[model samples]
Target: MFATVAFAQANDDLTINTPPSIVQCKTTMISWDGGVSPFDLVRISISLSMHNTETPNLLLSINLRAKCSVTEEGVVVEDFPNILPGSSFDFFVDFPAGATLGFTVTDNNGDKAETAPVTVQESDESTCLSD
Candidate 1:
């Protein structure tokens, strides 16, 4: 008897490399790798929940509004660019006080990868001063 092996190819192999940590009313740097389609648009979704707010179920697991386009000669063009393999993008997100945030990145091919859910802790620092 003989055995054979097969290797499968991935249409989209996007991966999120951001570590899982508690976000405490601060900006968190999110990064990823192994995505394709420079011409494809990148969509980022963040699930947020309020912890210190009086309002209930506010801003919970909502898709963040953002814009993406291609670049030409170091200038961003109003078109989708083809993202090469092994390329990466960085997203900076600010977590307001009393909010918990988790996020994921979707490639142009409709494939997505996410970081482990990170809970946002209430910070002692005030985002604004009360009058």
Candidate 2:
């Protein structure tokens, strides 16, 4: 299995450091200001606008994962703008290392079918967009 791993600078904006697998979009990576954050959980939300399509309720999924995501540490919280199905992007959060980055989808405008958040690495080389 092939995977891509990237590191973000301290108090840096990771959106500019887009990897080869990640497509540049409006996906905002809200990182740390210095040390810790005032909030506990770093929430990730998506804003998708689907137009005339065969399946209006077609579910498109994405797995946002990082090495340093923590509830108390205030890892990373990002907002995806105008995201569509099958489009690849990345979310950068201020995490340490070897920590579990669990993302809970909040205010899901796309009506994602996943009841739970998924942590996926860049491993899929195929797309099921034709269905």
Candidate 3:
């Protein structure tokens, strides 16, 4: 029973999802969360797979953006350039407090694939004077 519980805990922490793609499919934006700083580091992850008959070449890429308000528009914060096939990358961007954060990933062919958005809020335990 102990072994089973441990296995379950591990499995719960794991993320299982299909890859993101341009020609074949849209990329999957994993998660976006704020950290403990005035300029918090927001992490973004993406997976890509190009397996369509039209584009046989497997290519992947990821990028991130941010906004002041969740209801307002967002601007590109960080560009990850390119991510090759069978590989994944994670990046962080400094987001101001109370700002809305957004992310988007594109394929090697320069196509907008996936997007993830999150609103930044003051952490309960944050010690910073400014939110």
Q: Highest lDDT: give the candidate number.
A: 1
Per-residue lDDT of 58 in model 1? 33
> What 10-residue stretch in candidate 3 is worst by lDDT?
32-41
lDDT string for model 1 (64-126, tens) is 234433222212112223545434543333455433344455676677666665555556754
- lDDT per prediction? 0.44, 0.27, 0.32
Residue 76 lDDT, candidate 1, scale 0-100:
18
Per-prediction tally of clashes:
6, 1, 3
Candidate 1 — which pairs collide?
A: 37-83, 38-81, 38-82, 38-83, 39-81, 39-82
lDDT of 3: 0.32
Off by over 4 Å in 1: 1-12, 39-93, 128-131
Badly placed stretches (over 4 Å) of model 2 are 1-76, 104-109, 113-131
lDDT of 1: 0.44
Cα lDDT of model 2 by residue, 1-131, tens digit? 12222223222221111222321221333222211112222343222122433221222333244222222232234434443321233454222111223332212222221112222233223242222
Tens digits of lDDT, candidate 3, 1-131: 99997656433322212223211111233432221111222223222112222211221222344322211123343455534332244432232233333455443333333344343333433333223
TM-scores vs. true structure, each candidate: 0.46, 0.23, 0.33
RMSD of each: 10.1, 17.0, 16.9
Question: What does candidate 2 score on TM?
Answer: 0.23
